[model samples]
Each structure stands twice: as structure tokens, then as C-alpha cells.
Target: MRIQEFLQHHGIATNPFADEDAQTDLVFKTACIRSVYHPAWDKIYGDPSEPATAVVFGEKGSGKTAIRLQIARHLADHNADHPQQQVFVVPYDDLNPFLDRFRERFSARRRRRPDRVLSQWHLWDHIDAILALAVTQLVDRLLGVRDARHPAARDEPLDCTMLDGSQKRDVLLLAVCYDQSTADNRLKRWQQLRRKLGVSVWMSYWDIAVGVAVTAIVLAAIALLGGWNWLLTVWPYVAIAAGWLPCGWRLLKWTWKAWQIARCTRTLRQTIPFLRRMLMRFPAGQLEGQPLPVRAATDDRYAMLDKLQGVLRTLGFAGIVVLVDRVDEPYLVNGSTDLMRALIWPMLDNKLLKHPGLGVKLLLPSDLERLLDREDRDF
Candidate 1:
């Protein structure tokens, strides 16, 4: 029988492979296909921001990414209103092809999303990436739909270009620890955030940006303001200073903020004598901060989560269905194996992301579920 007739004859879904399946390709099919139908996906994972997310954990080759992908496909096909609902959980290795198709959707006037690459240790590694994205978020807040489709052109890129990963993460940590309203003057506030939070790295980057601008101005001025010979020696020094300026500024900015927070924490400790005495039994850092280098495999695991989340908030606002997958056990074990809560807390948070009209489901290994001591709300 012919392939199309064969597929039509069987009630089962078409062959899944892109190349091998003879339906699309054997390896995988575009998620935008129309064969998807659902009965109860609407009941369980249908409502995002509802209450608690459905989380499942599993080991390698456990069909975790697959199940989540299937559910994601269903959500996308059924809910056409919001096109950017997503499926994350593939490794960074697979992201290139995923993004290729996603971009095509944009040209087609449909919403799109690439799979989230779960790199090892990235959950901890994402401070820089998150901050970079946050800066873009600020830009989005300011510019709105004029720049909505092109995330690459905004502050996310500039944010990364200016700060090293470690420095960026420290800044993000401070942002989370503190909150403020940016309803107006987002650019001004976002710019001032580094100073308000005391992020030295931000200062360094800021100065670098200024120095580059100033050097450009100085060179332009040299044509009229002074002799070119002075410009030669001064230019190199200016360039060198301009070069280190951003790094130093970032270092200074974060250092200053860290200092202020430290002072505030210290003052609070001193004045609350009885409370301090009661809290003395608590461990100092493993709870508040667990450095990633100590646990080599514990970085950047969910580096893509914040990106996924930003898209969800956007989709939810637009009245679309957003499906997130491969998020169960979305954390990694780190160096301090001695303590358990560090790893447990993020896992707990991942499990709690459910809200109305939005769904994040997991196809996880049963063994992993046992290891984490959690139950899948859907399963």
C-alpha cells in the first residue's frame, strides 16, 4: 500500500520519525502537525497557574522527554490562541535544529519556542543568563511589541557581552533577594538597579560602555580639539582603561551591593539579640548559598527555565495555552552532598509552578520520583 493510504488506513497516529517514520522524517516531526487530539489533558494539565505543577522524575532512556513532548504537542494543537506554548527538557545539543523550526513559525505569523536545553550545573550557572534576559525584559517592558519578536537584539545580548557568568549570577541573586516596582521609567530604573543593589560588576560594565563612547567622542574631538600625536599615546591608554573599565565597574558594583547587604544583615543580627540567639543553630551558607564549583555537575541544569517562564507569562497574558515539559527533578546535585535541602528546594519549587490556563507536565522516571520523595499530581 502507498504510505499515505497506509497511514490513513490505520487508526494509530502517523509514524513519529521524521526520516524513518516516512510521515515527516524518521528522527522527529515538527510539533506543529495536526494529528494531535486529547480527552483529559484538558482536565489535568489544562489549567496553568492553577495550584501545583505535575512533576515526574526518571532516569536515562526512561521516555521522559518523549512523554512531555507528546503532551506539549497536544496542548499546542488544541490551543491555537497562544502559539508559543513550549516543551523543554532536551539537551543543549539538540537546540540548534529545534530553534530552526521555531523561527520558521515566526515567519509564518505563529508563536514559536525552542526546547530548553538542560545543561549540567546550569541551574546554578544561570545567574548571568537570567540577568541578561532580565535586562531584555526591561527593554521589552519599555519598548513592548515593537521589539517583541526579536529577543536577540535587546539587553540580553548586551548584558552577556558586558559581564562574566559569575558576576551576572551574583547580580541576579541580589535582584531576587530584593524587589521593587518599575512601572515607569523602566530604562532608568533598570540602569540604576546596579547602583541601588550595589553590584560592582554592573558599574564596571557601565563604565566600559561609557569609556568606549567617550573614546569614540575623544577621537572625534581630536580632529579639532588637540593635536593627533597626543591622541596616539592617550588613545591606547584610553582604550586599555576602556577595556578593563566594564569588568572593574561590575566588580565594584557587586562588591558595593554585597557590602550593603552584609551591613544590613549584620545590623539586623545585632539588634535582634533574642532572635539571633535562637537562629544561631541554623547553618550559615549551605542554605543561603552553595557555591557551584564544589559540586561540579550542579550547574546550569535549568539554565533555560527562566526563558521558558518569561514566554509563559507572555503566553498566559495573550490567552494562549503554554505547556512546559522535562521539568521534573529540574535541579542537579551539587558539591555539598552532606546537606540535602539545597537540591531539594529547587525541586520543590519546580513542582509548584502550576497556575490557571497554563500547564507544565513531566514524563519522569519512577525511580527518580522515589529518590525525590515526591508524587506526580497527574500520574
Candidate 2:
């Protein structure tokens, strides 16, 4: 029997078993994402009232990437339905940049096991990268909504009044390191930026107060020395420096630290162009260019993660789902079970996997299943 005749006799509309990539095949992709819903869909997507995280393990051709796309589509639908309680979706499927960064940063390692070194690359890096991705996407979406010049956003209808001007600026600045916007938009947000964002502060009141106190003390000393005439001539310069010196120094320190982060991490480094564009927005160059609130490598990850969750909450995002897939594609991993093991180990951190406001859907390759037994926690 001919193939078409056999297919017609079988009552099949088309070749369902074709040897094409499911992600690219139109019929297969639609079937996976829209037509058919998996049994575990609800569990993985989770309750909207409470954000949750889940891990899905499957081998090649097991529909892992398909599931990721399904979740993203579902969340987008949910957002479209309920704009007031929208969930931001951050798709972090790319791994090449991360792999490149790992290679560059740790060139001369002890060279024990590739997997071991991958594990030692630290969960903090993974967490930091995920947070950065979320912030970048959020900024891009907001800018696209406000400005029509950029690429059209996939955002559902969102209530702009969810965030105040200052809060909006805070979120905008967080993204400025990742995505570019017009100079006018950048300047607007820069001007609206607050001195403090929760525990984080752009410029501290104590620093300014100290400068004022020092200026007063110096002026008093000059008065006691009976050199009021000379003091008058120099007082203006002294006062100006003292008033602005502390603020400028703090900004310089933050800029230097931000530069370090950009240098050390490829994820952060990509944001440099956006940072420069933001800097140019300020004609006086007085705006602080410190975008991410990263401190040291270790502590900053957790701190920034918490801050990012808070920012998302303030932006009226009831949930933020980070979809991670494509584990074996990068040259660093290259389908090696060892490299995949090392890379995915840190991501299994319970704290990150089960964040309150953030939902993580980790679509892991089946090869990672063997390593799961080593650190078998409830997470």
C-alpha cells in the first residue's frame, strides 16, 4: 500500500510520526502547547493564588522543551485573562553566554572532575543570572509598553498604576543595565529615582548629614582662628566640596563595583551598552550608574534575589515564573553527563527552587536524574 493510501485508511490527517524537531514542526508544536495538555500541567504551572516551583526530568524527545513552551503560553494566557493579577514570564533557555563566561572566569582550575568544578561554580551564579534575566525582561516589557519605537512586547494588558513613579523608575533602572531605551525615557526614570529603595539606598542621608556637619565644624574652626576674611573667600568652595564630596564618592564606589560585576560575569557584561545609554541621559552626569545591587559574589546573589522578588511584587506581579530549559545545547556541556551534572547541581538549591513570589519550572535533561540521588532532599 502507498503511504498516502495507508495514512488515509488509518484516518490520519498528516504524518504525526515524522522525524522532525517537535519544537519546529507546526503541527507537533501546536499539539504539544495548545491542543493537548499534559497531566502534570497544573502541578507544574501551579496555583495562581500561591506561586510554586517544580522540576521536570525527561530524556531527549521526552517533550521537555515542549512543556516549557506550554507553561509560558499558559501564563501568557492567564495574564491576558487577568491583567490585574499578571504573572511575568522570564524564559531563560539560552546557555551559551553562561558557558562562555564559566570558561573565561575559571581558565586555570585544579582540574579534578569537570562535573565537580561545574558544581563549584556556585549556585549563587545561577541564582544571580536568573534574577538578571527576570529584571531584563521586565524592563523591556515596560519600555515597549510606554514607547512604541522598540520591539513590540508580548505583554498582556497591564495596569500601569500598579507602581508609583519612584517604584517604576527603580524597576526601570534595574533593567537599564540589560535593555536600552530612549534618552528621554531614561532621563525621566533617572529623575524620578528615589534616594532609597527599601534597605538599598542610592545616596544615604547619613553621608550627606556627615558632610554638612564637617562643613559646619570647619567653618567654626576658621571663625575661632580669627581668619574670617580668608575663610569667607574659601568657604564657598569648601562648603560646595563638603556638601557634594560624600555623595560623589559613594556614587564612584558604586560605579566601580558595578564595573567589576560587568567585568566578571558575561550575563552582567551584556548590560554595559544599556548602562552607557542611561549614563548619557543625564546631562550633568550626576545620576548614579549603579544598576544591580550586587555586593560581593556570594552575598549579593541572595540579597538581590530577595530584592528582585520584592520589586516584582511592588510592580503588581502576583507571580514570576522562570522557565529554564535547553541544558545540553551549550558547547561547555555538549551532551556530557558530567558537565550537565556540574551545571545543574547549583540550581537544585531548595531556597531558589521554592521561592515564595517566584516560581521556577526547571525542565532538566534525564541524564541529571542519576545525580538526584546524591542530594535527595524533599526539594
Candidate 3:
């Protein structure tokens, strides 16, 4: 069927999972759906001043990610027009429970058919974490958020039957994505992300312990047979130990640093970007001309977002789309100003934003919208 006609049947709301872009606000994005911009959906949102930044704000079940996926798919099918446009940072790690979320959200949506999904639960709380980075992708190297090796990657949404077995549905992670505004409550819960982290930590520690234990066993056997001389002379056991110990130490250090990064990230993610004005000191430049220097901050949010945006942009090649799911959980729990300052405000009027051809869409919390409106009186 014709793309526009299909969109009409589905309604205008953006559907990251749908095949094409619908002209409406909740309209899906695809190459076939002509934008008022270019004949094709190629160039960066046409004029940045026009779209500025198109955010898909909502909680997890409000369908924000679904909308983003549809956009990505559209970009993939017609990337020829936007050879430079790409899906910079697909949250491949975040699709762990989409079907269940869809089911929950669909149920809630059936109840009221509200014009927007932000009223539901803290649907897009997770967006609070990733939106800034997504915004940075517009002019960065990772415009499309993929490696050069696979610039035109696209995954069609699972068949309806994928979620058909029971009253509620469940599905495995199929592809990377940017947001999760599909939940009924809109960017509300992020137990899935937290659960994923818990599983990752558990598995990583298990693997590390296993590796060390195996190495120790081998070393003990060497000692049993002879000593350091016998082991090192033949197996280089002493040298091996020397090399492995530092490697192991560094690995452990990095892992610990990563944990710290996660914790620090949750705490100061919002305020990081605003402090980026301090980038004057760092020796930073990208192979891609679209460059932003590293900045000094009492916090690492600025550095992290800058780096993530830069690297991912270069990888994306085409362009970048930021999908922020579950954006309200943090604000709902710990509403702080530094985060708002360091991260959110920086991107709101960021230099990266000044660059042409980028799209930063987020599914944020309704409470955040209210809070931000109150704080800045944007409302």
C-alpha cells in the first residue's frame, strides 16, 4: 500500500517500529514518507532551525523507540539520499522487554487514547540517561550511530505473532534502538535496564573469577612439578605471571572504573554538558571535521557525552538519531539541578546542536516536562 495512506490508517503518531514516516506528529518515519524538507527524508532534518531537535518524549511504553525504529528503517531503506545520515547510537542493549512493554502500554492506551503518552507511568525515565548523547550525534562523526563496516543496517519489526502467545507478550532483543516511549505509562520504569546491569555484573564477575582460578590452578601445577625456573624456562610461567597480573589488574581496574562510571553517570548525567565550556585544555580532535574538544568538569558527564557523541557519530556515517526511553525515573526519584545544568541545558543549546544534519529525539517523563517548564517557565 502507499506509505502516506498506510500512515493515515495507523494515525499520525510516530511509530519507531512502523515501515514509514506518517505526516502526523506520532507519525512513523521512513524513506517513502516525504517530508516538507527535501523530496526525500535524506538531509539532516532539512533545516536544523526548523526541526531544531525532534524529541520523542514519553515513558518506556509510549512507543518512542518504536517510532525511532521506524525512522531508522526508513533511513536504511533510502540512505542513498542521506549517504551521510545514520542511526548513531541504537540502544541494542535496551530491547530486552519491548513486547511486554508494548502490551502494558497498549492496554493503558486503550483506556484513554490520550493525545500524548507522557501522562502514563514514568515511561521514558531511561531517556534521562541517553538523550544528551543522542543530541550530540547530529554533527558528530557518528551521525548514523554505526560502524563504517555496516553503515546501512536495518531490522524490520518482529511479526505481530512474535507477541501473540499469551494475554501479555514477551520477546527477545532483536535489534538496537534509541528510545522506549511505547510503554502505556510513557518512559516510566527502567527495571529492565537495571536488571540487565545486574545480570552483566554477575556474569562478568563469574567469568573473571573463573579465569583467575584456572590460571592459579595451572601455576600450582607448575610449582608442583618444579618451581619458577622450571615453569618460566619451559612455560615462561614467571614471565607469564608478570604479564598476566598487570593485565588482570588493569582489567579489574577498568571494570571498577566502569562501575564508577555508571554510578557517576546516573548521578551527574544531566549537568555534564553545561560545563563543557571548559574543553579549552584537552588535546581533542576527530578524524571527522565535525569536532568538539574535551572539556574539564568537576564531573565526567561532559566528557562522556562528548566522547560518546563523537565516536558514535563517526561510526554512524549517515546521521544520528537519539532515542531516549524511560526518561523520568531519575528525575522522579532524585530531582537535582546539577544534572539538569550539566547535562540537559548543555544539549538544549549546545554547540553540537549548532552543527547541521542531526536529530536528537527523546521520550522523556511528563514530570520532567512539568519540572523543566516550572524551572525555566518554558511551559
Give the Å error, residue 285, model 2. Answer: 16
Best-to-worst order by TM-score is: 2, 3, 1
Q: What lDDT tens digits, residue by residue, belong to model 1 across residues 4-37? A: 6777788646654324222234243454233433
RMSD of each: 17.0, 7.1, 16.1
Candidate number that wins on lDDT, 2 or 3: 2
* Model 2 stretches astray by more than 4 angstroms: 2-5, 8-14, 106-120, 145-161, 176-252, 263-266, 270-298, 376-379
Maximum-lDDT candidate: 2
Give the runs in model 1 whose Cα sits over 4 Å from its true position.
Answer: 1-40, 48-52, 57-63, 74-254, 258-345, 354-360, 372-379
lDDT of 3 at 260: 39
Q: Write the per-residue lDDT of candidate 2 for residues 173-261, one digit (tens) a residue.
A: 55544432334464454333322222133333556667778777777777888767765596656776877786677667556655655
Candidate 3 residues 196-257, lDDT tens each? 22212233344345557667777787778776666537465554465466446645544443
Clashes of each: 50, 0, 102
